[model samples]
Target: MSRQELPGLPTEATMLRDFPWVVVRMRCHFCRRGGDARLAVLAAKHGPYVTMGRLVVEFMKECAWAPWNPTRRPQKYGMKCGGYCMDLRRPDPPDLPPGMQGLQLIEGGLSEKLPAAPAEFERRKRVGSDD
Candidate 1:
C-alpha cells in the first residue's frame, strides 16, 4: 500500500497487477494538457519505448464530435473526439485547460521557433490573429 504523489497531481499511487508500475487516480485532477493520463510509478527508469496509450475507437459512435475520440477515423471529417486523445479519466477531471508543450505555456515555444514570417504571409495576418 505504499503511495507517492507528484507536485500538482492529486492521487495516491498503488501497485499494478502485472506491469512494473503503480496506479493513482485519487481525486481526479484534470491536466491542462489536452489528453488524459494515468499515473504509473516506475521502480526503474524505462526508455521512450514505454508509453501511455488512450483507447478511442469505442467512443466514435457516441461522441458529439471527435474531441476526436476514434483515432481510426479520417481527419477530413473533423470529429474532435475521433483523434489521438480520448480516454482521459482516472485521477484527472474531464475539465481543464489545454496541456503545455515542451517549456511553452501553449503549443510551440522557443524550442520550435519558425523562420521570419515572409513578407507575403505577413500581409495576410488576420485582424485578431497574434501569430
Candidate 2:
C-alpha cells in the first residue's frame, strides 16, 4: 500500500522500511534545532522490521527515560514498550554541552556518525584511569 494510505502514521515509516539507513528527524530541546538521527535495519541478517524493538529500546535508552505511553494501563507509571511504533520513539533532547548536539555539522568530517569504540591503545590507557 502507498504511504498515503496511512494518514495517522508519521511520514518516515515508509522510508524506514525501504532503506537500510535513514536520517530521522529528532527534536533538540536545548538548541531548538532538529537533529538528523540515523537508523538502519539489516534485512538479510535480522529480517525486515525485526530489529525495530531493539532499535526502539536503544533510542529510548539514549534519551535517558522510558518510552511514554498513554494508552496502556497504569497511566501513572510513565513509559512502555514502543511496540511496532518505531516512529514513536523520541526522547526530547536534553540540554547539551556546547557543540554537543546529537549529530553535528563539521568542517572536515562526515555528516553521519555512529557510536564508536575506543582504540585499543586508548582503551588500555584509560583502564581505571578515572579512579
Candidate 3:
C-alpha cells in the first residue's frame, strides 16, 4: 500500500514489539552517536506499545542537535537531529513498470472548481442599491 493508504504516521504503526531483532540499534550521524539496546529491556522500560518515533525522542533528549530540545543552541541554519532506528526506516517507493511512465496533473482539475454563490448575494445587492 502507498504511504497515504496507511492510517497513521508510519512510525506510529511500528511499536517496540514489532522489531524481530534481539537488539535494537539507534544512530545519529550528526552527533556521531550510536547505541544498541536489548529489545526486551527497551520494551520493559518504555512499554511494548511505545512507537519507535516516541522512543527515539526519549533517547535523544540530551542531544544538542535535537530540534525539540529546548536548551539546544541556535545554529546558522536549524538542523534536526538525524537520529533514526536501524530497523524502522521507511522503504523507498517502488519503481514503476518498465513500460509505464509517471504522470502528475498540475492544474485544471475538478478540485479547482468553486461552488456557485448563494441566493444571499441578491439580498445584499438589493440592500445596497441607491434606487
Best by lDDT: 3
Weakest lDDT window of 10 consecutive positions for candidate 3: 89-98
TM-score of 1: 0.18
Model 2 residue pairs with clashes: 67-79
- List the candidate numbers ranked by TM-score, top first: 3, 2, 1
Instruction: Report the number of the highest-TM-score candidate.
Output: 3
CA lDDT of every candidate: 0.35, 0.42, 0.71
lDDT score of residue 10 within candidate 1: 27
Scored by lDDT, model 3 comes in at: 0.71
C-alpha-based local distance difference test score of model 1: 0.35
Total backbone collisions for each predicted model: 20, 1, 0
After superposition, the stretches of candidate 2 with alpha carbons farther than 4 Å from their true spots are: 1-22, 28-35, 39-57, 67-131
Q: Which model, 1 or 3, shows the larger lDDT?
A: 3
lDDT per residue for candidate 1 within 1-131, as digits (tens), equals: 22234332322121222222233122112222233234333224332233333122332335555344454566665535433333222334444455632244567788798768655543567888787
